[model samples]
Target: DVKVTQSSRYLVKRTGEKVFLECVQDMDHENMFWYRQDPGLGLRLIYFSYDVKMKEKGDIPEGYSVSREKKERFSLILESASTNQTSMYLCASSWDRGGQYFGPGTRLTVT
Candidate 1:
């Protein structure tokens, strides 16, 4: 079975703090992605890595960065937390052009 796991299910931080969200997949996929889900905007990809040390910025990568050092792990970093950055973050992994499986999601809140 393919499984994706995030380090946190929920996180609360004050404004201006730096936050790190971790994700690990069991599938050994080459592509990993970070997305933020908002009510109307739906899921917006923040960043993605197709290979180790190779990353591609998605539509909303302004306030976010990603790391993929190993085949099974990927990390997301929020440089500066803010109220507007609060959203449900999802991590997904896929085998070369295969179906993507997503983690439960991390609900982040910034005050």
Candidate 2:
């Protein structure tokens, strides 16, 4: 069974703070994705990595960045946290066109 783990379940940060959210997948998936979910906008991909040391920006990548140093770990970085950046952040991993397994999201609150 594939298992996904996130560094934090809930996070609270002030504006302008740098935040790091980490995700890990047990299966050696080749694809990892970072997405943010809001009320009306639905799931918006922030960034994704196809392989180690390779990343691509997704639909919304203005204030976010990603790193994939290992096949099983992917990190999401928020350069400068803002109030509007507060949302439910999700991490998913997949391989060979199989469905992705998502981690328990991180609810971030920026005030």
Candidate 3:
């Protein structure tokens, strides 16, 4: 069975603050992704990592970065959070061509 967990279910941050969102997957999947969900824009990919220490920028990568130093853990970093950046962040892991397992989303609010 695959299980994904996020460090926080809800988070609040001030403008310009550095924020970190952590995700962990137990399945040892090779692919991990970070995405943010908004009302109208839907899910926007922020970054993805194919393997340890190997990351690629997704659809919306500006002001954000990612780390995958360990196979089971992936982290999303917000360099400087802004109000517009507030959204529900999701983490997912999967094998090549396999269905992705997603963690409980972390709702982030930047004021």
* TM-score of every candidate relative to the true structure: 0.97, 0.97, 0.97
lDDT of 3 by residue, 1-111 (tens): 789999999999999999999999999899999999988988899999999999999999999999999999999999999998889999999999969899999999999
Candidate 2: what lDDT? 0.95
lDDT string for model 1 (1-111, tens) is: 999999999999999999999999998788999999999999999999999989999999998888888989899999899899999999999978768999999999999
Q: Show pairs that collide, candidate 2.
A: none
Q: Tell me the tens digit of each residue's lDDT in model 2 across 1-111.
A: 899999999999999999999999998899999999999999999999999999999999999988899999999999999999999999999985869899999999999
Q: How many residue pairs clash in model 3?
A: 0
What is the C-alpha local distance difference test score of each model?
0.93, 0.95, 0.96
lDDT of 1 at 107: 99
- Give each prediction's root-mean-square deviation over alpha carbons: 0.7, 0.7, 0.6
lDDT of 1 at 71: 84
Pitting candidate 1 against candidate 3, the one with the higher TM-score is: 3
Name the candidate, 1 or 3, with the larger lDDT value: 3
> Which regions of candidate 3 are displaced past 4 Å?
none
